[model samples]
Target chain A: MADKVLIYSRFPKTMMTRFAEAFELLDTAGKPAHEVFPAEELAGVRAVLTAGGTPLGGAEMDRFPKLGAIVCYGTGYDGVDLKAAAARNIAVGHSPGANAASVADIAMTLMLAATRRILVADQYVRSGDWAASRQSPMMRPQAGMPSRRIGVYGMGEIGRKIAARCAAFESEVGYFSRSRHDLPYQYFPTLEAMADWCSVLMVAVRASAETNHVVNADILKRVGADGFIVNISRGSVIDEAALVAALTDGTIAGAGLDVYAREPHVPDALTALPNVVLSPHIGGHTLDSHVAMQNCVLANLTALFDGKPLPHDVRPEGKTA
Target chain B: MADKVLIYSRFPKTMMTRFAEAFELLDTAGKPAHEVFPAEELAGVRAVLTAGGTPLGGAEMDRFPKLGAIVCYGTGYDGVDLKAAAARNIAVGHSPGANAASVADIAMTLMLAATRRILVADQYVRSGDWAASRQSPMMRPQAGMPSRRIGVYGMGEIGRKIAARCAAFESEVGYFSRSRHDLPYQYFPTLEAMADWCSVLMVAVRASAETNHVVNADILKRVGADGFIVNISRGSVIDEAALVAALTDGTIAGAGLDVYAREPHVPDALTALPNVVLSPHIGGHTLDSHVAMQNCVLANLTALFDGKPLPHDVRPEGKTA
Candidate 1:
């Protein structure tokens, strides 16, 4: 018997059909993706594929009696309740290394935007105020600073990629991670050390119970008034309130944020700051990444039907790899 | 006797004093710097210090009889007449590496702004038409495309730096120069070949008599409708007419430009296009670069006085080492 796959989010019709052509697809259409999971839609579904807005929780897993697995379409699995899925003996898998390059590209994009003041300069040019702005004593530095030190909070694929780009600018790169890896640059013993060493800090770690609020008030203070921050990882990685306070008081230079604590609904404080550059949580929403991620889903589905080990299974709290 | 250095362009008091402290400075305070040479102000001047703006053509050089060397406070030496300097045995020097990193940083900035549709998105967001504008069909793939091939047109200092940063995105890099070097990536024989291999192309080559309009109508057309172009080197390297035509017809994807055919002035054709990102020719304008270039000027002064080989001498065709 064919493995039945249920797509739980709104996706491109062409791509959905590409997956459906290979599986016994169970249709679940026009259901507001982010609305709480419908009980009726879970009836007899063997597996579900979802991402971002369509979060799958504990109670929803209980509805599917014969559900063997859940596949997240992207890297971040925060929306999916991994612990609950584990308790139900349901496998949870994600598309790791799928959008690694895409996320890395955006991370560098944000870093460059923050460092070079692209938005400010572009605004000056568009407003027909380039000449006036140049003459205006109000303008600080139109060009980016040279020879800055860059600090990376995570040493994963995306973080390392950002580090590589930073190093190309001849910036000294120092990183903080759980375990030390052999890198071209030095590794700091702690995030505080990393923060103290750099005027530009980039946070690219995972968001979990163990890592939430890793960049807090104390760390923000350590970054100081001369430093800038860029959060491309998760909104929870940074203490948003602390960020707001620091930004308002001019305790930190500026920030470029791709994610937020409450995304698609940013705080008024952040949006009001002239120094900050904010984007909706669409960093990984590139055509290249979407296609790559969907292909990963195909591989995971193929493996499940073949009774083989899934490629990127998220183990339970203490389960063996 | 202390070597007398003439200060031409106006600078901050502190910066002027700082330069003076390094050498015996001639303060052309009341009189216009241009009038100084033919007038009594040229009496004891041994060296001249000027920014990139001061015109030091053949006629101007005829008046500075005792001038042994000139230190350009910026990278480009367009205002200096090469033939006149060579004829009179007056060494002409410029700051090269001083601005490489700065230019590379802003080059990448324009690339990101153009590629990610930042300017357009900003306009869309601020107009309160976010919903309508975003929902409108765009030719762009998405926020950022990943794993696509990237091409660099001159593999010199700034170009190589841009390439190194591009590598961080896991972009397969291909480059075109007069001759291939032993770089980490493949080398394309021509610009057309490079464009054929890449979805994004960056023009970081020199602009000169031979290289003028190298990226003309044919090359732009060859790059195709799905490719993007970034020019940070010199505006003359690209055919402005061809670029305008391409952008108008959508023969190429998009463009990010720093230099222009007529600078301090931009063409309405480019500004009118929603797909282009434009910046004034300030790619190498940074505090660090300014200081570094000043130091290069000092080096040129020292070398000329001590009868040593001047570093970074501008050639007949304007290439520097």
Candidate 2:
């Protein structure tokens, strides 16, 4: 008999096909598992597969006394309630750095799109502005990437990839992380110091309660009126209200955002601005990243079924945000 | 006394302020010099400063008997009639490689934008489609940058920079140029072979009469339905009609174009498609690139007036394109 694994989050049925082949899936379909499955079925569930963002606390974990593992679909596992999982001795697993390259690719994409004003240029040609010989301040020449300073807020897998790409463009790279790693980029003691020094502040920091709204009015101001902010990490890292104000009043030149304070519902004030290049939260949404992450999930689940430690278990201190 | 430099093309007065300070003012404002100025003034013209695309043939050159030099503002001097300049013993100068980095940056921008479907994702967020959980085939995962084959169609300054950036992303790099250079990337003997081998074909070949429409329907077909075409070189290099058909019929996946076959007047057919990310020939239009190009122009003009060789002169064999 296949080991029963509860699908705790809502995903398109297609994404669940692989897990269904290996295990008996009791899909809650984004509802409370107890509501979908009776007490007898819940007691037999040995594991849970979920999106990293969905909140799974101690109360939920207790529903399945035999639950030995929790496997996150992507790199992030912020809402897993690490303490609760630890107290109940649930081995947590995640696909670390599986989506880093894709996330970094979007970071570069957003940075170039915002800094080069490609979106504005696109409209300029489309709206007959260029043909009419119409002039706008927006068409003014922009500085190139060479020798520009790029400050990364975090120095994890995604940040390192971003830094490497910046370096290849001949831009100076700097970063501020929890602790300085022995990397080629210059280390800053604080995000403010790095923000002041670099013209393009790239937020790749892992999000936490402590990091909520870390990139506020002060950081935006420090980035200077000519600077830009590119955030690919998480939405809560920035104070969206402050970002809106900064963009409105020219505290910063532009922004390229993938994440938002509220998922799927970005404030209208942001969408109204021309300087921003906004994208839905799909940073790690790539074919290769998905396959890699799925492999990790499968590996973790197989290990748990075999009574072995997860090959890609998340450490308590290094929980993915 | 200031040297006489007849401004041959239309430019806003602000852009001419710097040139006006160094040269005797005879602003034609894009009109023919003979129409704007008397024969006596035209005879005294020592140099001509014009855009590289405006036609400057033997007939035009014959009017300026005293013209010592033809200096191009930006790269591509295709309109200068290089043969005519050589026949007249005129020194031709341009800002060689001054904007290579910027052009390469745009190539990367277009590649990422088109491949990752950033614009689609942006629309998804802005239109509340994401909130409604709308489904799109485009929202399907994309392959990450790592190990992806990137074939550069030209191995010039711009192509070299693009290859280096792609390498940093851990992408496999290949190229096909007229003459092979000592580079780390794999070189193909022909464009077709490279196009078939690479998933992303970056068009950076210099535009010339012989190279016009080099990337035709056949080339587009070889790029395959899953591949992309990024052209930052010149509009003349690709068959715009074939490109339109290919894009419409899904002969190729997508394209990122900076230049079109016609200036400022793109066919409505091309603009109607959602697969392309279009820009109006703004590849080298950056503040830093402009400043660098201007310095080269200044050096070329000053050298001509001082009875010295043009420092940034275009050799007969190495005309800017």
Docking class of 1: acceptable
Q: Write the per-residue lDDT of candidate 2 for residues A1-321, one digit (tens) a residue.
A: 569999998877888888889999999988999988899899998999998878899999999999999999888777798889989899889999999999999999999999988888888887888888889789888878984789999988999999999998878899999898999999999998999999999999888778999999999999998899999988889999999999999999999999998887899899888899998878988888888888999999999999999998877456532
* Model 1: residue B32 alpha-carbon error in angstroms: 7.8
Per-residue lDDT of candidate 2, residues B129-162 (tens digit): 8878888887887777885799999888899999
Off by over 4 Å in 2: A316-321, B316-321
Q: What overall lDDT goes with each candidate model?
A: 0.74, 0.89
Q: How many backbone clashes does candidate 2 have?
A: 1
Tell me the tens digit of each residue's lDDT in model 1 across A19-114.
888887765553642254455545557788876435678776767777888888888777778778878878878888778777776776777776
Model 1, global lDDT: 0.74
- Give model 2's docking category: medium
> TM-score for every candidate vs. truth?
0.88, 0.96
